[model samples]
Target chain A: MTRLIDVENLTLRFSTDEGMITAVDNVSFSLEAGEVMGLVGESGSGKSVTAKSLMKLNASNASYSDETKITLHLDDGPVNVMDLKTSKDMKVVRGGAISMIFQEPMASFAPAITIGDQMVEQLQIHTDMNSKQAREVSIEMLDRVGISDAAQRFKQYAFELSGGMRQRAMIAMALSTKPKLLIADEPTTALDVTIQAQVIDLMKDLVKEFGMGIIFITHDLGVIAQTADKVAVMYLGRLVEQGAVRDVIRNPAHPYTRGLLAALPQLDDLEKPLVPIPGDIPSPLERPPGCVFNTRCEEKVGDICSAKVPDFTNVTENHRAACHIYTQGSDK
Target chain B: MSDDVLISARDLSVHYPLAKGGLFGPKPVVKAVEGVNLDIAKGSFFGLVGESGSGKTTLGRACLKAAPITRGTVRYTDGDVDYSLTEIDNTQLKDYRTRSQLIFQDPYAALSPRMTVRDIIAEPLEVMGLTNGREETDERVREIAAKCRLNLEHLRRFPHAFSGGQRQRISIARALVSRPRFVVADESVAALDVSIQADVLNLLRDIQQEMGLTFLFISHDLSVVAHVCDHVAVMYLGRLVETAPTKDLFKAPRHPYTKALLSAIPSLDPDDPNKAQKLEGEIPSPTNPPPGCKFQTRCPFAVDKCRVDEPKLEHSSTDHVVACHRWQELME
Candidate 1:
């Protein structure tokens, strides 16, 4: 697999009224070209924030730590994303080479502007296409995402379209720039289940056609299962497990991952009721010293689970998780 | 046997008058719910599923008399007292309001941040004049709070101090405090995290069993509706496309819309790679819907007939009712 984007020791913090809150705590992962990677986490797990950090879109209150290295391997050469200071310099990493779709497509668009105009604007900014060329390309992309009457739809405003159409338009605009790395932050969260299903299918197809690496972030386990090839599980801003989708779902070594799977309501399993993890997610300020999920974990193994942070242990060649139980097994 | 029929809606229609009465012109209207018939079996978890603007919520509220019904009749019977909704006088409506309650979506919005948990839960009882005095109200509130798994000590603290799941539980307790026979839990756990969602769901199921209460659980999530609801009703553009027992609906959805809805959900198991059913386009606007089937715009099996003629909801089997011209064809 060809390496696309490499994130190493990426630590991020936000200066909130409470304290210096660590949003993405020393999280490290890499994506290969054409690989669909699922970033699964509950709210405040820092999935979206970590994706935003790639384009340097953190809020004004965000503060970065030293050694936060994020390198993108483009066709030209390797570029350190953290060091790209100026907007001119950052443009290469932003919409030019990297793009994003959001949970709510309406927010990504101006209500007053037509969906086509927004796409054209995005394409124009990133490419040297003329208005006519942009218009054609935008319409084609819209059609590609399953929006019918593509030409006439170009004249319609965001509100004039339904939620599913708006979502498709947003996807079309995001991909119109043809970014190598697409960060979709809970793109289908706001959509209806059926509409969400359609959006997820479109994304999987887009990945195959466009051949780009996607940082797919969502709390829906079912979506991740259907779309993602590899999965990375996050808890309180830390990576708990990362592996091939089949392996993680089949055999989750981490207690948190197991709990999450058990908690999911499935059709095949009506005999057993859903068992949610015992307690509420701790506030970032009250983050545990060692294991983030120790508070809610069913298999918390005494002081070690709370007093010392577990190291990442490879359970399989491609599967890795941070837990002491796996460390007790023979090293792979 | 008769006691099992908690609430029955017969051709219920809720139409809002668009406030524009010109000098000599009649007021225009927006038909939110149009001729809907439904029945809630006693102690049964009934799920109402629909996209935005489907008017499912209005249908729910009309049962409680919260929304004005322009046409059709709604009958409410708790085995003891039975009243026809459309013909019911103010006195009977007031008594019904105390028996049928609403659990709002968006816990943060549904609950008052200014009020403590105890007071929040106590509001419904106080408002409806259910209890004789503060002592009886506090006792009832505390009892439901315990069943909801709310911490008694935390009841003194405001809603801001609670998490989404906790706040939702408080919402449930508040709705239940009036000793209502039925609850309209409109998107109750829609905003919660996946793991927390399971917990809240389980809580609801347990509460349903204990309280012997009928739940008109309204949500857009098929997976959630599948697990929680005994019976499921699929709505689109102010009409019920299909209604069946939850298991049967998931296994074999008769309506194209229902099948499309089932096909749209992402399965959680990575090995269980179920591709989403890709619909052609968006749902049409209710005000300017297509001449025939509302789903015809996006229906894959749509023919010329579908574009011009409406299909009445027909039963595929004893319990299953579907509205589609090609439902039999699709089953083949």
Candidate 2:
């Protein structure tokens, strides 16, 4: 698999009224063509910030560390995303090379404009397609995403369509540009179980057909398990674990990862009692000194967990976790 | 109806007048919920699952008497009191408020941002005059807050100081503070992260057991429903299609809609084959739903009979009920 994007030592902070809040703390990950990377985290976990950083879409208040590097490898050459300061230069990273589908389809789409018009607008901005060509391509993409009577739907506004159709339309608009990377941020969270299943299937199919790298951001482990080739678990702005989805789900090394899986309501076995992490996630302003998740981690290693941050320990060939337990195990 | 049924509805319908009416023409009605019959056993967690526009929310609101019921009857029966919701006066309605309550989906929007957690939880007790004084209200709020796993100190702080899970707990605390025998939790945990969702689910189950409260748990997620609910009902386009015990519903769903719904949930096991019976179209518009079975438009097994004749709920077993013209034949 060819590398599509690489992020290294990406530390980001937001200057809030309260204080400087660390949103993404020294996170690093890479993606390859046609691969799906699941960035799993709850609110304030910095999963969204990490994904948004690819296109430099963070708020104006956000400040990144000087050592942080984000390199988007296009067909032409590798370009540092952080260096793209102007809108003209950033366009290559924004919708040109990377497209994003948000959780709320209504917000993403222009309610006043026809679905086709907005899609055409996006394609025009990203590609050299004329109005006619853009409309044709938009309708085709809409049909590809499973919208019945695509031609009729092309003339309809976002509100005219159902929630599922609106989401499908948004996906169609995103993929119509033929971008290399697609960042889907909780795309199916607003959808029903059945519609979500459809959308997930459509995304999987699109990935195979387009041969594009996808970053699937969601808190649902089941979605991650089914859709993601690789998984990264985030807790309180830190990447606690990263590995192949199978490995991470089967044998989670990080205590937080284990706790997350345990907390999920298992459909296969209904008798299992849900075990939530003992304590609440600490506020980002009051982030713990050592391991970010130590406040909620079940298998805390006493002083070591709260005193110093643990380095990543390789649990398997491609699986790694940053935890005192794994580090201690390796030392022994 | 069983003696243990705390709430029962027969042919319940909730219709809203649309603004599309002209000066002279008859006002068009948006049948948010139509021809729905349900029975909630005392101290049981009943799950209601459906897609958007499927009327789950409106149905829940109707049970709470929040939505105006246009037709049929709803009965609230406890040990001694038997009040018909449709025939209840102002005094009876006020008393019913103490016997039943609603937990909203969005914690952020549901709780007053300006008020502290204590005041938010205490509002219900004060509004309904459930407590004699501020001290009594505080005592009840503290008791319920503890049951929801909220710290006493945290109650002094505003809702903005808390996370989504904690805020949801506050909402739960507020809902249960009135000591209602029947509670309608409308997608209460949908807004929370999966990890936190489990915590709230466990808390709800624990509280239900302790308080002996019957919950009408409304959600669009099938897995969550299967995990928390003892029995489940499937709704589509303002109609009830199926009702059964959770295990039986999951094991062998008779309605095509139910079967499709079960299959659509992305399984934790990646190897699990995607359901072969993938539903095709979006749910038809509720205002102008196709005459007959609303699910027929998307059902793979839909026939001429299904297209013209609406199917009513029929019992397949002692506890299982389904609405499908060909359920018996299709099951074979």
Candidate 3:
């Protein structure tokens, strides 16, 4: 498989009124063409921030470390995402090679404009398609995404569509660009369960047909299990675990990952009581001295857990976790 | 009503009238909740599951008497008092307010940013006039906060200082501070992370057991409902489609909609083949729902009879009830 994108030591911080708080710390992961990576994390785990950095979509308040490197392999050559400073330069990455669909479709779409116009606009920006060709493509994409009466619905505004239909239209718009990479930030979170199921299936089929790399960001493990080929678990702005979805889910090595799986209400096992991870996630202002997850880690090993951050240790050939238990005596 | 039943609704309906299209044209009405019969047993955790526009939230609010009841009756029967929600007097309604409460979905929006944790929890008590003085209110606040695993020191801090999980706990603490026998948690934990969601769920269960409280847990997440609720009800387009015990419902769902809902939930097991009975098309508009069965538009096994004649709730098993024209045939 060809490498689609590679991220190295991507550290991000926001300059807030309080101070410069780290939102993503030394998080690194790569994706191959046609592969789906599920970036799993709770709120404030920086999964969305990391995904946004790929397209350089973060607000002006955000800052990235000098070591941070994001490389997108286009047909021409590998483009250094960080080097593209201006919006004009960044256009090659954003909407051209990487397209994003947000949780709230309404926010992404203009209320006054018709859905078709917005989709056509996006297509025109990224591609060389004219107004006529863009309109036809948008309608075809809408039909492909299962929106009935596509031509009629295309003329209607975003407010005219139902929640599920609006979501489908957003998906249609994103895929209309035919980007090499798609960053779906909690795409199914806002939709109803039945609609969520439909969207998930649609995305999987799109991946198979387009062979584009997708970064699916969500906190729902059940979703990740079904859609993601590889899963990267994030906690407190850090990547604590990364591996094949099956291995990480079946035999999680990190305490945080294990706690997440245990916390989930499994349909097959209704008898098991949900075990929530102990303690609350620490505030970003008062981040821990050593490991970010040490405060909530149930498998903490004495002073080392609180004094030093553990490196990623292999639990299997492809699965790895950053936990004291996995690398207890290796460093010593 | 049976002695074990805490709250019962018979053919309850809530309809809101829309403005007239033309000066002489008839005003349309949004049938939010219609012909719904439900029974919540004493001290039982009942789950109400449905997608958006399915009227699950409206049903929940109607049970709390928060929404206007256009037709039918909702009766609340505790040990000594039995009040009909549809026509309760001001005195009885005020008294009922202290007997039941609601936990909102969004933690960030639910809690007042200006109020301290203590003040937020105590507000309900003060408004209800359930407490005698500041001392009594503070004591009640501390006690419930402790029950919710909130630090006493944090009580003095504003809601902005706490995380999502902490704020949700505060929401719970405030709901229970009134010491209501019945609580309507409408998508309460839906906003929290999986780990924190588990924490809140466990907290809710523990409090339910300790206080012997009956909970009406409304959510779109079937998995969470499966773990926390003893009884489960499935709703569609403002109508109840299936009602059964949690385990029984999961084990053998009779309604096509219920079966599709269960299968639609992406499995946690990676190897599990995706056999989701994907419900095609979105739910029909509630204002102008299909002539016969509301789910016929999306039901995979929908038949001609389903399109011509609406189905009534029938006993599929001893305690399970399903509203589907072809349930028996589909089961066989």
Candidate 4:
């Protein structure tokens, strides 16, 4: 398998009125062609910020660390995403090699422009396609995404479509360019469960057909289990755990991951009461001194948990976690 | 009505008239909730599950008498009083407001930014004249806030100063301060992080148990409903398709819609083969719904009979109701 993207020591901060607040702490992960990686985290977990960093999509106030590096391996060559200083230079990563679909399809699409026109515009910008070719490709993509009457829907504005259809159209537009990597940011969160199922299946099929890597971001672990080949669990802007989907979910190494699993209401086991992780996620300004999850973790070992950040320790050949319990000499 | 029934609805419907479409032959009406029967047992946590446009929220509003009851009757009875929601007068409605309250979904928008947490929680008591004076209101506010796990310091801060989960606790504190007998939590935990969502859910459960309060928990997430609710009801296009004890409903769902819904939830076990019966097509528009079954368009087992004559709710088993023509055959 070809390596599609590699992110190393990515750290992000924003210059705010209050002061500089770190949105994404040191985080690293990679994806290969045809692989699906699920980025699971709650609000302020910085999952979105990390995804945005891949395309340099953060606002002007945002800044990245000097040690941060993002490399996209394209057929032509390897491009350093962090080195893209201009919007023109960032264009290749933004939509050509990487396409993103947002949670709210309504906000993503222009109310005035027809869906077809917007898709055609995206294609024209990303690929060497003419107006006529782009339109045909857009319609084909719409049909491929299971939108009925693709031509009619092509001419319809975003408002004319139902919530599910609008979401499908968004996926159609994102995949129309045939990018190497697709970043789906809670794409199914806003849709109904039934529609969410349809979208999830559609993405799985598209991945098989297009051989594109996908970074699926969602707070729902269930969705991740069904879609992602690998999973990365983040808390308070830090990547706390990463492993194959089965390993991470079945035998979560980190306390935060275990707490998250315990908190969820599982269908298979209805007798169990939900155990919420104690305390709240600290605000970015009050970011915890050491392990981000120490405040809420039930299995806190000692003062070391609040004194120093633990480095990643291997739980298995393919699974790893950042927590004192898993560290060698953290208790001392 | 049984003595245990806290709130009951018979043939309930809520329809909203749209503006005339250029001298239309007949004015269009959005049948937000139509021909429904429901019973919420006292001191029980009842879950209503549905997708958007399925009218779960509208049904909840109608039960609270917040939405106009266009037809049928909704009766609320406690040990002290019994009131029919359909024929409620201004005095009774005002009294009813003190007994029934709603917790909205978006914590960010639900809370008033200008009000301090203390004032926000105390407003309900002041509006209802439940407390004697400023001191009494403050005392009541502190009590409920403490129950919601909000500290004395939190009460002095504005909504902007707190995170989503803390703001939600404030809202919950506000709703409970008046000592309402019945509460409607409409997607209350949907906005919080997974860890915090669990905390709030546990708080809601604890509050319900301590107060001996009846709760109508409306959510799109099935897993959350499964764990928190004793009984669960599935709604589609403003109609009840199935209602059963949560255990029975999840273990052996009779209605095809309910079955599809349960299956659609992505399993946490990655090794489990996903045999989800993906329901195809979006929910039919309320204004132009199909004549017979609203879900027939997407139901895999929908037949000719399901297209011409609407099915009525019938007993699938003791205390379990299902409205599907082919449910029996499909179950076999």
lDDT of 2 at B19: 88
Task: Go through the candidates in order and give the C-alpha RMSD of each one to the true structure.
Answer: 2.3, 1.9, 1.7, 1.7
Tens-place lDDT per residue, model 2, A1-332, is 89999999999999999999999999999999999999998877998999998898999999999989999899899999989899999999899899999999999888799998898898888889899999999999999998999999999999988889999999998999899999999999888777888899899999999999999999888899899999999998889999999999999889998998898887788888888887678888899999988888778877999999989989989999999997777677
User: Which of the two candidates, 1 or 4, achieves a greater DockQ against the reference?
Assistant: 4
DockQ of each: 0.72, 0.72, 0.82, 0.82
Question: Each prediction's Cα lDDT score?
Answer: 0.87, 0.90, 0.91, 0.91
* lDDT value, residue A42 of candidate 2: 80
Whichever of 2 and 4 has more DockQ, that candidate is 4
**In candidate 4, which residue pairs get closer than 3 Å at backbone N, Cα or C atoms, i.e. clash?**
none
Measured as a fraction from 0 to 1, the native contacts recovered by model 2 come to 0.73
- Candidate 3 lands at a TM-score of 0.97
Docking class of 4: high
Candidate 3 ranges with C-alpha deviation above 4 Å: B1-3
Off by over 4 Å in 2: B1-3, B22-25
- Model 4 clashes, total count: 0
lDDT per residue as tens, model 1, B265-327: 676666665654666556666666677888898888899999998888787998899889988
Docking class of 3: high
The CA lDDT at A250 in model 2 is 90
